[model samples]
Target: MTPLLEIALLNIRPGQTEEFEAAFAQAQPLISGMKGYVRHELRRCLEDDHRYALLVWWETLEDHTVGFRGSAQYQEWRALLHHFYDPFPTVEHFVGVLP
Candidate 1:
């Protein structure tokens, strides 16, 4: 099966970019240590410093929805990073449709 890609469009509260990034760095290990984690990347938007795009690869959709989200680590992840957002981010999953 093709790997799954999880995407999140994160918009941090104004003036909190640096603090959010620091929190995210601390939260990274929580997600990366999960069972189906393959890899991930976080990028800041060029035009909007408060915005970010996060891409996380998993072995399967369940690996993220079930394995990761259902784990206690997720709580820690949330506590560490969730408050930085002005509004909650939306998360979606995708799979490769072509080579």
Candidate 2:
């Protein structure tokens, strides 16, 4: 099956960028070790310091929506990182089209 790319646009609370990043650093390992995880990256928006983009590649969609989201580790991930967002982020999946 084709790998899936998960994208999330995060808008962090004002004055919370540093703390949010610190929390994300700690939470990264949780997603990385999941069953179908291929790779991932987190990027900060240059124009908006409080905005971030998270990209994660997975072997299959279920590996993330079911496997990871269903695991206890996700709870830990959420606890560590969720509070920093001003408005919750939207997560979407993509499949390679051209190459």
Candidate 3:
């Protein structure tokens, strides 16, 4: 498996969690079908209505940089979810350091 991965931390606007989730549910299928995408998991913080994390695993960094960014679906993804964020989201890439 490729080592590159991404995690996006998001803070949704207050009272917007449900709207955000509904939008994301619509986009999930498109995201999963993209080139080089291995998997993604969306999690909401149990105690917070405005917090979420998206753990996205890909085959390579290029899967996100080249494939996802260049695809038309990205525009849809952005359109569907961007406005729900409070200060936009932060994306961090990582490599597994221990078993």
Arranged by lDDT, best first: 2, 1, 3
Error of 1 at 41 (Å): 0.1
Candidate order by decreasing TM-score: 2, 1, 3
Q: Let me know the TM-score candidate 3 reaches against the reference structure.
A: 0.93
* TM-scores of all predicted structures: 0.97, 0.97, 0.93
Please provide, for model 2 over 25-63, each residue's C-alpha lDDT reduced to its tens digit, 9 standing for 90 to 100.
Answer: 999999999999999999999999999999999999999
Better structure of 1 and 3 per lDDT = 1
- lDDT for 82 (candidate 3): 95
Alpha carbon lDDT of each predicted model: 0.94, 0.95, 0.89
Q: Model 2 segments beyond 4 Å from truth?
A: none
Highest lDDT model number: 2
The per-residue C-alpha lDDT of model 1 at residue 66 equals: 95
- Give the per-residue Cα lDDT of candidate 1 at 79: 95
